[model samples]
Target: MPSAHTKSPRAASRTPLIEVTKLSKVYVNDAVETPVLFDIDLRVQSGEFMAIMGPSGSGKSTLMHILGFLDRPTHGKYRFLGKDTAGRTDDELAIIRATKVSFVFQAFHLLPRATVLENVMLPLLYHPTIPSAERQHRAQAAINAVGLFERTNFLTSQLSGGQKQRTAIARSLVTEPQVIFADEPTGNLDSVSGIQVMGALEKLHASGHTIILVTHERSTAEFADRIVHILDGRIASDSRSHSRRSSSGLTSLK
Candidate 1:
């Protein structure tokens, strides 16, 4: 029998959720152009777990920003769900981000004084369509998914590093986006805490969420089924290979 992590044939055949062709990014300051990424072509399929790995100057973080619609590429054809995003205005991009994109970062960014439940529901507060009354219900569902339900009502300041990260994951999941961008999510964590977070991400992938993780650590990238490496602002390699220790072997921190 196929496991939950297995993508259905139908899913495999669908149009890629993200397609970037000849993508390039250049920053302009005082009329000077600083090139960051160049002619990058990539496709991210639905239900795939992929990691982007690179050193500090490789521009991976910039690529992540472009992928997440948090920033726009200077030149490229970027299609999300087969529709071109080149013409989208800043507000349109913001709408799309709010409605269809999820982000997890190294910084927990949770409200220090807010309860876990409140922090998780913060995204919904800005959503224009999600009913106010349904906010709590949706937040609860996301908290449960990340296995942070036990800490739902606890203040974020009271949580440990791992717990805080879990809370952040739940918060990101609250919007229920199709793709998730994790930017060096374990950068601030210790080994044990990192394992817990990776397992949580693996469980998310097993549940069919498309995960696009950005990391500088090989150990962290191993958790992904596919690893794409960037060097000097260009793709050095993209291998669907990993040396991940078995996920089942790790004791889940949540």
Candidate 2:
């Protein structure tokens, strides 16, 4: 249900970035079937901030995996940008995941020995389209987006937990994805660091990146424009909320 204060869904006029209907997932290991998601239906419009919140073992992770193209649904129809994704091959999906979508997780996933700039530039190394001469400039721009320009040369191992996560964000942005899947991005940080990371996410949203966050914290979920709750492999509630907490701790990257 829409809250009384909930405005119409963001980017209502924009094309849908993702659409899924009757989506289901089941694992068959040694012929032992284990169902994970059931008859799920969801649509995400372009330029929106959405958060998926649920307790452990509630199938949120599985749902995210399917949504992010990491795992395939056993039965369902999924469309990306109005095109059916059901017929896509593994290589096609990989190409989409590599060039169109990005991910940020609780783990920093940075190289201890690599400087922040090098780490951010890593993705372009595999991209056949990017010119080597432009990679550094692109990487620097991403680091600036996440407010890590000053630390561009710092080693990942020497940074604080929050800084490391921001570095991860920079890496995610280097590819210029249309959508980002952030799974428990704040799970490993302290309270202050968590707020900073969330603030960074908010800043990104303001810049027109579609954000899909999965978290167990209400405070973090509240940051998003809408929240979807999952329980027992089913969606319990899907509602819009405009309750973004104050980004008081935000710092200027400039």
Candidate 3:
């Protein structure tokens, strides 16, 4: 886990980046309804880094999907930036996801034939507000942030594992989203590459991006300001990082 040199910014009064109440999920297969997450209540402050941890089949991934708006909860209300998302249409959710949220996956999901810069620029294609030149500039800046400016022209296949992952990080950040969701970010990397990718994530968090990472690795969970542990579809524990202590001595994870 990486530690921050500067303290995170305090949240303004009466606003939460994420809010979940009585959230639950059920999957029905072969006429059998299987519950995954049960009555989960969670809140994430603006610019906070949170990690979700659990063993396989513990429903951490299911919870993540709900949080990311990739799936809807069976019973619950989710408020993102004070707006209830329960009744939002797929197009509405897509709009929010495109403009406000970005995602990075365990596998570098870059297009195989596209150059690093091009791959990073792909997100901007959805934004009619940005011009082509500005998109390229933003993409280059994102690539540079991950220390891959020189390799921006290289194809994904031409890069090393670490470099490819860095490109993925760059692509995620190029959209300048308010929040980022990363799922098992280091699961597919070697130790050295994993460390590098984790370092990049830490850097992004340090820059005040709200991040939610879903991973089973304790070491990876340590990078977050709060770690929410799930088991058998329920929240087992929620622990805060040592650095996010409040003036009154309360911490986010606690």
Candidate 4:
């Protein structure tokens, strides 16, 4: 019999944006093996906001890395946008990473000396095919999307924690990627600033961006349409959120 992680016929009817089956990861040092993930199966549809929640050392970040194409699983299968990724070369993976997926880490990785516009435009520098004028236009649009158009000229070092995060988000958006992985996006911000960052993410989701967020805070996880709980290197629960979303706004759980 096929494992539970295998995609069902019904699920196979519609193409998933991301898929994983019986995925596992392990690290070996001096012949000592330490396992981090075990027998994981998951799927994400386009334009869906999904959150993976777990405490530190629960393997949530490792799962995110695998899903984001930053790291490969030691065993099992991973498919991105319907393409199996098992034997893809590093250059091929880099191309997919550059064109299909974007990531935002807890620590803002912006260049301190660069202006917000310049930082946001960094991703486009990799694609020489895109004209300089088009690159600037996309960068400006992304900055505006994150509500940072006015601060485009401000140096990243001069920005607040919240503003820095928004700039990072803008950088992710400059690529117009199909999938975005955010690892503890609000981890370093104050409550108010975190709310602002969440609001930006929510707006992005509303506009049809597929978002996969990893967070420890229930309040932050509540923003996603679905939440998956991870425990001891395995999936504990996966459920759709009941939070209300209307034209007015999201009505989070009390």
Best-matching candidate per TM-score: 1
lDDT of each residue in 23-114, candidate 2, tens digit only:
99999999999998999998887777899999988899999898888989999998889888887889988888878888888887888899
| TM-score for each candidate, following the candidate numbering | 0.93, 0.92, 0.89, 0.91
lDDT of 1 by residue, 181-210 (tens): 999888999888888888888888888889
lDDT of candidates 1 onward, in order: 0.86, 0.86, 0.83, 0.86
Cand. 3 Cα-lDDT: 0.83
How much is 51 displaced in model 2, in angstroms? 0.3
Worst 10-residue lDDT window for candidate 4 reads 1-10
RMSD of 1: 3.3
Weakest 10 consecutive residues of candidate 3 by summed lDDT: 245-254
TM-score (C-alpha, index-matched) for candidate 3: 0.89
Better of 3 and 4 by TM-score: 4
**Positional deviation of residue 199's Cα in model 4 after best superposition, in angstroms:** 0.6
Clashing pairs in 4: none
